[model samples]
Target: MNDKNHKVYLHKKKYTRDKMKDYTFLLPAGLFLTVFLVYPIFYNIILSFRDINIGNLIQGEQPFIGFENYQTVLSDPLFRTALTNSIIFTLATIIFSTSIGFAFALFFNKKFPGHKWMRSILLIAWMTPIIIIGTVFSWMLSGDNGIINELFISLGVMSEPIYWLTDTDTALLGTIIANVWISIPFSMVILLSGLQGLPTGIYEAAKIDGATRFQQFRHITLPLMKPTILVLLMLGVIFTFKVFDLIYIMTAGGPADATQVIPFLAYQLSFGMYRFGEGAALSNISFLIIGAIAVLYLYLIRKEEVM
Candidate 1:
């Protein structure tokens, strides 16, 4: 009995020591998250519920305003337009970018001359600064003296120059085109990596069995790539949802608010309009939407793992 008790005591002590060591490893990240991520999230939540303003900050007293800010935001037409645009932008980006990326990945997965160099060139768009891309695209898409219109006129594609940025119908599409150009490279790289990591033996076996390329891809490749596809889709959705810089630089959400997105709307409320509480509320709303998406993704991933 005494010997058994001593062994139990030793085991308990070892378990406690292991827990302490694990905590030590977690300390740095835990501290950083508390200071930066956690605090800001809570502070933003608090601000959303208050009557904070630029002047209030200088006065150092932000009175509680209950749900007034949220009510105002909900009643705003600009907010509705911004929300619609954000949804449309995100969905279009995910569909087009993922499809094009997958196609490119399939193409580049084959043995071809200059494939590596082609891939490197494609990645330049992804690696370049978003601001620079937005600025350059804005210049090229300009109405009268822009290179795009000039080339189109020279090629007899258009008799007169089209106003790409100023037109309400075309302005948003222009931003989408620029966004797609920058986004496809990222999707390609992810899908390409996934393609390379697929098991070669499966393809070889399929070939030995006299399987057609399309049939093999349908039965084998797609099933193997489902997980990667899910990840890429989620990433694309998240990236496009938060898009602000490109829209801001290109159109300033102008031409009658055609290209206004949630982030830009939030920025307008906070800085441009000096409505801090409303801006915070918009941010919180955006956070809730994104958080719900993240949670759904995590739940799906866990379910997949279990299956």
Candidate 2:
């Protein structure tokens, strides 16, 4: 009886040890995610439903306000303008950044003299601090004595210096240009990695079969790179949608609310205007938009895999 009992006890201990080993691998990540990611998300959701403000924040009396803040944000003209600008900014960034990045990937993927140096230089824009980029671009696009205007004038392209960031019509465009400059490098790096990962034999086979470069790119390259391209597109849309620093630093969302995006609008509502509830509502809305895009991207990815 003692021998039998000893063997059973040792087996139970081994079983418990194996279970612990399985959980050990997941413990750290689970803890980190719960603390950092899950907590903030839940807190933000709670804040969005509350009438939180500076005073209430200090007093810890953040009471719920239902959907009143959301209604106010939806009805506001300023919010409408911000929504429009955000859509435009997101669309333009997606088009220009993705296209330019793909072009650069093609260029950089080839073995050429100083290719490494060229790639390093291109990545400088990505590596530079956003605040510095914003400040330098603001100075360069200044209406009066900006380098861009001076260059255009010297080249006789306009026959005069153009006020790039002063007019409402041009202000948003100027911000987009600055954003594109920063974003292109990211897209290029991602696409370049995808390009490099592609099997070379496929291209060689296509070439041997009398396929032209354009045909190969259209049929082979594009299809093969679809997953990577989708990821970049989704990321570009999300990043561009949340653009705040560049617009805030460059235009403060205006010459006349021309460059205001959802994030900037939320900032103004919360900090600048002291409407914390409305700011939270706007933030929630932005989150919804981005969340929707992410879901769509996931669906597409899954569908592609299924096909």
Per-candidate TM-scores read 0.89, 0.91
Task: Count clashing pairs, candidate 2.
Answer: 0
Residue by residue across 162-278, what tens digits does model 1's lDDT show? 789889988888888899999999999999999999999989999999999999989998988988888888888888999999999999998999999999999999999889999
Indicate which candidate wins on TM-score.
2
Clashes of 1: 0
Worst 10 residues of 1 by lDDT: 296-305
Candidate 2, 214-293: lDDT as tens digits: 99999999999999999999989888899888887898988878788899999998898777888878998999999999
Q: What is the Cα-based lDDT of residue 26 in candidate 2?
A: 100
What's the true lDDT of residue 15 in model 2?
100
Instruction: Output the worst ten-in-a-row residue range by lDDT, candidate 2.
Output: 40-49
